[model samples]
Target: MAHVATWKKDMVSEIVKDITENPVVAVVDLHGIPAPQIQSMRADLREHAILKMTKNNLMLLALDEAAKQRPGIDKLKGSVHGQCAIMATDMNPFKLCKKLEATMTPAAIKAGQLAPKDIMVPKGPTPFGPGPMIGELQKIGLQAAIEAGKIAIKKDTTLVKAGEPVPPGVAAMLPKLNILPIIVGMDLRTVFEDGTVYKKEVLAIPDDYYKTMFATAAHDARALAIDISWTTKETIVPLVTKAFREAMGLSISAAIPTKENIKILLAKADNQMLAVASKSGYKSDAIAARLSSAAAAAASVKPAAEPHKKEEKKVEVKEEEQVSEEDAAAGLSALFG
Candidate 1:
C-alpha cells in the first residue's frame, strides 16, 4: 500500500469538517480564472463561504466520507473533473451561485481559447496612425482604410464566431482594439443541499425571474380562488365587488327596482317616453315646461355648491360629448325599435 501523506490527510480532514458543518457543498470549475482574480474572489467570499482547492482524488475522498453522515453528498463527485474547487457555505445554493457569478470579470480573448461570443470590430477610426498597422489590421480580416489621418475600419467585421478558437493573429489584435470577448469567474457546476443535488441549470435563474414567476403564480392562485368563491383575505374584496357588480347588472337587465337603481330606472323610462313621443310627433307643452323648469333648478343648484361642482359638471359634459356618433345612431335605432 502507498504511504498516506500527512498533508493530504490534513486536507481531507479539513474538507470533511467543512462539509459536515455547512449545509451546502458545491463543486466549481476554476478553469479560466487567473490566480490573482481567484484570490480576490476568495477574499470577497470569506464572510459567506470558504473555497478550497485540492486534488480531485482528495476531494472525492472527502465527499465520500461526508456522504457517510450527510447521505447523498457524494453525488457532487460526478462533477469533479478538470480544475475544480470545493465551496462550503450555509447560504442557499442559488444565492451562492449568484454571489460567485457576480465576481466574474471580462477578459481579453487568448490564443487557442474558444471565443465566448461573436467578435465584431466596429467601422470607425482607430488609434493607429496611417502605416503598416493598416496592413496588420487587414491581415486579421478587418477592412482598413485611411480616414482623417487615422486608420479606420471600412466596415464592421466578424473576426470569430462563438465556440470557435480565436486565431492567434486575431487574439493578438483584440487587445490593441480594446475588445474583450471572454468572462472569467468561478463557474459553479453543482451543489448538494439538504439531500438534494442542484445543477447549474437550476441555480442560474435570476432573482427577479423567480420573483416574477412566484408573483404570477400567486396571481393565478388568487384568480382561481375568486372563481371558485374561496374566501380568503386576498380574494374576498375582489370577489365581493365582482358579485355586487354582477348582481347590479342582473337587477338592471331584469328591471328590478331598488332604491339604489330606482333613479336610473326612472331616467331610462323618461328617455324612452320622450323617444316614443318624439317619433309620434306628439308635443306636450306641459311636459316640456316641467322638464325645462327641472333643468333650470338643477343648473341653479349646481353653481351654488362650489367651484368644484362647476368643474365636475364640465367634465360630465365633456364625457357626454365624447360619445361616438355610432352610439348616437344606435340609440336612435333603439328608440324606434
Candidate 2:
C-alpha cells in the first residue's frame, strides 16, 4: 500500500487539531482573490479566526478524522469545492459570516464576470476628456456627453443587471471610468457549529433585518403569552400589573371602595350628583345670591328715581241719551206704515 505524503499527513493532522479546537468550522470560497489580498485578509482575520488552505482531499480526510470527536464537523465536506479553504473560529457562524462580509472591498469587474448587483454609471463629469472615449462609452450603452471640455455621463445608466455577465466592452470601459462594480472578498459557503451545519443563505442576514425580526418575534411572543394567560418569568410582572389594573377597574365600577380607588369613586359620585342637580335647576347659596342681586339691579335700572305715575282721564255719559224701548218700537211701526 502507498504511504501518505509527509506534508499531507502533517496538514491533515493540523486541520483535525483546528477543527477540534475551534467551536466553528466554515468552508469559504477563495477563488479570484489575489494572493496579497488573501494574506491581508488572513492578517485581518487573525484576531478572530484562522484560515487554512489545503487540498480538497486533505480537507475531506481531516474532516472525516475530526468527525469522530466532533459529531457534525464532516458536514463541511459537502461545501468543499472550487478553490475552497477552511476557516476555524471561536466566533459563532453568523458573526463570522458578518465579519467576512464587512471585509469586502470593491474591485473592477472582469470580462465575462457576472455582476453581483445592478451596475450603474453615475451621472457626473468623469476624468475622461472629450474624445473617442465618448463613442466607447456610447458603444457600451452609457449615455455620454461633452460638458465643460470634459466627458460626462449624461445620466445614471445600468450597464449590467444583477446575475448578468458583464460585456467585454462594458468591462473594458469601467476601469477607464473608475467604476468599481464588483465586490471581492472571502465568500463563506457553509459553517459547522456544534452538531449543525448552516448554509450561506441562512447566515447571510442583514444585521438590522435580523434584529427587527427578533424584536418583533419577542414582542409577539409576549403578547401571545399574556393573551393566553401563560405564566412565565418574563410575563409575570406585566401579568400581575394587568391583573391589578383590571381588578381596580372592577372595584371602581362596582363602587367597592378600596384605598386605591376610594378617592376616584367619591369624585365620580360627586360629579354625577352635581350633574343631576344642575339639570334639576338646583343652585347653591352663592348662585341664588348672585341671581337675586341681578334681579334687584334690573329693577333699580327701570326709573325708580322718577317714580312712574300713570295719568287718569274721566269718561262721562248723559242719561238723556238713553232711548226707551217703547219709543224705539213706535218709530219702527211708523217707518213700516
Candidate 3:
C-alpha cells in the first residue's frame, strides 16, 4: 500500500511538470473513443505536438501547481478518467484543436458513453429480414425485418436522440452497425504563450474556418501595414519600391518611367485603388493617363541614339572611295591606293 501511494505521488509530479513546462495543454475526453482511433490520434498528434494519456487525478494535481499562470486550466479537473489524452503544443492552439476534431470515425456505441453532440441517424429505407428480430427492430422505431436469413432495416430510422441514453437493444446492435456518435477528447482546455493565457475556445475551431479567417486577417494586416508605413520586408517590398521610383523621377527631368519601376508602381497603385477612391474618387483611367504622359515626355526629351563605331567606319570608307576615283583620273592612282 505504501509503495502504491509513493508511485502515484511520483506519477502526479511528472504530469505536473509536463503541463507546467509546455504551458499549452489540451484535455481530451476518451470516454467514447475507440481503442484503435485513440492510438491513431496519439501517433498523429506526435507529429505536431506532445500528447500525454494519463489519469485525471494526476492531471488535476499538475494543473493545481500551474494554476497561478493559467487561472482557468483547472476547469479540466473533471472528465479525466477511464480514458483521457492530454495534448500540448507551443504552436497555434486553435489549429491543433481543429485538427483533432477532423479525425472522428464511427465506432460501436458503448453503454455509459456521453454524446459529444446531437446524434442524428437520418431517415432512409431499411432492409431487414422477416423474422422475430424484425419485430424487435420495429419496436424501437426502426423499419427492419429478417429477409433472406439476414436482418435488414427496411427503411431508415432514428435509433436514438441526441443527449439521450442508448436503449439496451439499440446499443447492442450499434456495435454490429459500427456507429459511435460521441467524440471523447478535450472539452475545456487552455494555452499559455508569451505571458498570455488562451482559453480552450481559442483552439476550438474548424480547420477550414480557421484557415479562411487567418488568411483574411493576414491580408487586412498587410494592407494596413503598407498604408501606415509599418511594413517589414514581407510587407514593405512593394510599397517602398514604388516610393523609391517616384523619388527617382523627381531627380531626373526624364519623363520616361524606368521599366523596373513600372511593375513596382503598378503593383502598389493597384493595391491602393480603394484608398485612392476613398480620397480623391478619380477614375482609374484618368490616373493612368497622367502617369503615361509623364513617362512619354521623359522618353522624348532624352538624348538621341549615338552612332556605333561600325557605322562611322562605313562613312569614312565612302569618302575615301570618292577621293580614290579623282586620284585615278589625275594619274595619282598609285599614291591613293
Least well predicted 10-residue stretch by lDDT in candidate 1: 312-321
Residue 6 error for model 2, in Å? 5.7
- The better candidate by TM-score, 2 or 3, is 2
Q: Provide the clashing-pair count of each candidate structure.
A: 0, 0, 27
Report the number of the highest-lDDT candidate. Answer: 1
Model 2, runs deviating above 4 Å: 1-10, 21-23, 68-71, 92-95, 200-337
How many residue pairs of model 3 clash at the backbone? 27
Residue pairs in clash, model 1: none
> Global lDDT of each model?
0.82, 0.80, 0.58
| Model 2 weakest lDDT span, ten residues long | 311-320
Using lDDT as the measure, name the better of candidate 1 and candidate 2: 1
RMSD of 1: 9.2
- Model 1, 1-337: lDDT tens digits are 9999999999999999999899999999899888898999999999989999999999999999989999999999999999999999989988998998888888887898987789999999999998999999999989999999999999989999888999999999998988888888999899999999999998899779978999999999998999999999999899999999898777767889887665555555555544455456555664455335545655675646565544322211111122334444444444455
Worst 10 residues of 3 by lDDT: 312-321
